[model samples]
Target: MILESFDRRTIANLEAALERVCDGRPDGADHELRSFIADAMVACAKKGQTTLGALTEAGEAALARRGISDRKQA
Candidate 1:
C-alpha cells in the first residue's frame, strides 16, 4: 500500500518515465519498452513508497486516456 502513498514529485517522475517509454517510438512501442515500463511500475510498487493520491489519480486518468491500463497484477 505504501506505493499507493507516493508523493506528487515521485509520482511525477514515474509518470514522466512512463511517458518517455510510451512516446519513444515512431509507430509504437515494442515489447521491450512495455516490459521496461512494467518493471518500473513494479519497482515503484514496493513498500515504503510514498505517492500523492491526487497525483496518482491524475496519472491513472492520463494512462486511461491513452488506453494504457495498469498491468500490475493483484
Candidate 2:
C-alpha cells in the first residue's frame, strides 16, 4: 500500500496515467472527467496499485466507466 502517503514516483505515475488517458480528449478535456481520472488513480494507489501500467489502466477504466473511448488516433 501507499500508506496513504504519495511519493514522487507515485505522483509521477499517476500523472503519466492521467496524461495517457486524456490524450484523446478535447483541449480542456472537461474538468469533471480529468478529476474523475485523477480520483481513480488516487483510489488505485490507496489500494496498493502504484505501478505505471496499473495506474494507467485504472484511469482508462475510469474513462470507460464514463463511456469515453480511446480516440487518441482518431
Candidate 3:
C-alpha cells in the first residue's frame, strides 16, 4: 500500500535523524534534541504513524550496536 511505503520512509527518516542526534560524545550531547526525537517517536507511536514494534526493535538494536542498552531508561 502507498500508506505503508510512506510509513516506512517516515520511520527510516526518524531513525536516521535520531542516529545523527546520537552519534558522539562520552557525556552525550543534546539532551533537548534527543528528548525532542523521543517525543516525536512517542507521538508517532500514539498516532499509529508507523509499525511500532518494528521501529522500537530497530531502535533498540541500534542502541545495542552502539554499546548502549535501556534507551528508555536512559
Q: Could you tell me every candidate's TM-score relative to the true structure?
A: 0.37, 0.78, 0.34
lDDT (Cα, tens digit) per residue for candidate 1, span 1-74: 43576666676656665565467456246665455554545454454342544334443444454454444431
lDDT of 2 by residue, 37-63 (tens): 889899999899999999999988888
Q: Is candidate 1 or candidate 3 better by TM-score?
A: 1
State the lDDT of candidate 3 residue by residue for 31-67, as single tens digits: 7546545555545554654554544544445445444
Scored by Cα lDDT, where does model 1 land?
0.50
lDDT scores in order: 0.50, 0.84, 0.53
Which residue pairs clash in candidate 3? none
Better of 2 and 3 by lDDT: 2
Give the poorly placed runs of model 1, Cα more than 4 Å off.
1-3, 26-39, 42-74
Return the clash pairs for model 2, or none: none
TM-score order of candidates, top first:
2, 1, 3
RMSD of 1: 11.2
